[model samples]
Target: MYQRLITSRHFVPLLAGFGAMLCITALSSLGSAVQSSVWLMAPFGATMVILFGLPESPLAQPRNIIVGHLLTTAIGLSVATLVGVTPWTLGLAVGLAVSLMMLTNTTHPPAGANPLVVMLAGEHWDFLLMPVAAGAILIVVFGVLYHRVISGKQYPKRWF
Candidate 1:
């Protein structure tokens, strides 16, 4: 099973990575042009890796990517606001995000960093919307379109 998984044609990941990076770059440019407060967040880099490089992962699915980031971002922002951004609070936020994500069945691993991002940046509620939620949704949109245009691969094996 492992060998079969590893033996994919080399170009698959390469092409996917290129396309994903292009999409992300475009998103960043758009965000800059619009002068949005928070256009891109750090975690979305990992998101690109999953969405493009490992499109087969359940974490890469539209539902998981969108919900996981949104849910975790909300939890992280809440924790930061409620508990304040101390060492203990940061730890608590990440733990809560992970646990909540697992319980919700929306476990996108990249989202695990959301708490740290929020706490470290000292961000508030708005952080949940722009860079976290909006960015994630855009990535999903790009993934869906990219897969449609690219032949021989079906993205978002399932929607919800």
Candidate 2:
């Protein structure tokens, strides 16, 4: 997975998408839905653009980005709700999210933070569906438009 993820075809678009997302987020002042103050969510959006939108590498394919993030959000939110908001709960939420994502075969690394963000923020749990899940969907939509329609790249090679 690491070898495939780091290849030139994957890395170049990943970086470009990351930069693009950052610029859009900054300009729009959406204030980053991710819990970490750092621009960590950028990579999640970037990965979607590279894999789902441009899809030069197998790992970057749309299935990996969309299914991966959906699984991550579901597991993360479920764990957060079950465990409640505490230090250990937060840890468990993130851990469960990661583990579930990996198990589900949709492992988008950056989404590991979603559970933690929901737990720490003490959100109403609906946050997972909105802003977090919604944001990801928006990112995917933007990537499709930018990489496919505009840039002439094929996105969502196969919709499962």
Candidate 3:
């Protein structure tokens, strides 16, 4: 079963995605180092999967990536700040984030986790800047550059 899961066809895409994540994480590390701050977050791993493994997916598009993250982060921060990080509040925040993303047409599956991250960490507004906004933008920009220069796949099927 394990052998069947790993195939020759999966090698390059897997490698490419892995490499892209490495580059992205490394850049995040560099940003953290230079600024002496936390620039990495958990949700970005899922973002990388969508951006690199499913570049042609609608979720991988620039608009979805950026707006989805921004919206979800805003919701997460708002809920966390206003309601406090109770179990019920976290649930409500996640539900609201998902609903808002859908309503705004900025649905991104990875971003669904942002509410949990923010609430759990008790993060304030700056949480949106470093890991949410900066990380999402980096992933988009990296995916575009990596696919265009190295992988030769269209990074974004559409910008909007």
Candidate 4:
């Protein structure tokens, strides 16, 4: 199963993009919410952009980033609101968000920690929309530009 999954064309792009983004995230010191949020760093956005944005992947496109992060944030905030922040509760929140993201078909694995981060930090719910979702969108946009410049890969096949 692992081999089969990794052999897909999407795999290489995902890995490459992730590596590039990780490098950028580490070297650059951007103060954006996305940068501030540990959960929204390079590997996460890189994977989403490569896997979903490139070749116009339905799952990796900008919409997916926006929608997926939004959904995950909601799940996390909801869990946090319902139950105060505790180790067990935070774990449950993260697990539930992951399950929900999969069920909803917006499975952005890196986003799995969003709920726990928000819950533990006791941050406002709006943080998801800002640095998280917006950060993701920015990453996808950057990826699109980067791929086009470096490799001539068309992104978002069709802009909505």
lDDT of 4 at 92: 87
> How close is each model in CA RMSD to the real structure?
4.0, 7.2, 4.5, 6.7
Where is model 1 more than 4 Å wrong at Cα? Answer: 1-8
lDDT of 2 by residue, 1-160 (tens): 7445544586756656664655456424554544532322444654544454345554455556666666666666676667666778777777877787777776666666666655565656565555556556666666566655444556656544
Q: In candidate 2, which residue ranges exceed 4 Å CA deviation? A: 1-19, 22-54
- Rank candidates by lDDT, best first: 1, 3, 4, 2
Evaluate residue 91 in candidate 2 and report its C-alpha lDDT on the 0 to 100 scale. 78
Q: What would the per-residue lDDT of candidate 3 be over residues 1-160, giving only the tens digit for each residue?
A: 5434433577757756775667667767767687766667777778777787777888889989889988888888898778688889888989999999899888999889988888888888887887778777877787888877766677788887
Error of model 4, residue 19, in angstroms: 7.4
Candidate 3 whole-model C-alpha lDDT, 0 to 1 = 0.80
Model 3 residue runs over 4 Å out of place are 1-8
Best by lDDT: 1
lDDT of 4 by residue, 44-150 (tens): 54454444334457666666666667777777788778877888888888888778877877766557767766776786776866567666766667667755654
In model 1, the worst 10-residue window by lDDT is: 1-10
Mark the regions of model 4 whose C-alpha exceeds 4 Å error after superposition: 1-59, 157-160
As for candidate 4, its clashing pairs are 52-60, 52-61, 53-60
Error of 1 at 1 (Å): 26
Q: Please provide TM-scores, in order, for all candidate models, with all chains considered together.
A: 0.90, 0.62, 0.87, 0.64
Give the winner by TM-score: 1 or 3.
1
